[model samples]
Target: MGLIVASGLCLALWVVLWCFHIAARDAAMISFSLFLVAAAVRTVGEQVRQSNSREG
Candidate 1:
């Protein structure tokens, strides 16, 4: 769920930047970076969740 939201937000940001006439390359790069961050966060969250479950 959080991952979905993060991805959506990144996509929205890209769209908004495009609407404002930002360069496509720049906007894509920014959004791609955001998506990578989101993916990393999601991976960390999953690892934490798994560790907690094991400890519990």
Candidate 2:
């Protein structure tokens, strides 16, 4: 969904900043990464559940 895309973009931005040595503080980046990971996990879980329901 849009959230997944947004999180992915944020992560990409974080990586780019890191490579350029202009990233924010470690805590902020890590927090963003964690939130993105959580969103991804939830999205995947929802997809799987939907697929299983359809199959049933």
Give the winner by TM-score. 1
Q: List the candidates' TM-scores in order.
A: 0.59, 0.57
Error of 2 at 17 (Å): 20
Off by over 4 Å in 1: 1-22
> Per-residue lDDT for 1-52 in model 1, tens only?
9999999999999999887775777789999999999999999999999999
Clashes of 2: 0
Weakest 10 consecutive residues of candidate 2 by summed lDDT? 19-28
Candidate 2 lDDT, 1-56, residue by residue in tens: 99999999999999897866744576678999999999999999999999999999
lDDT scores in order: 0.94, 0.91
Q: What local lDDT does model 1 show for residue 47?
A: 100
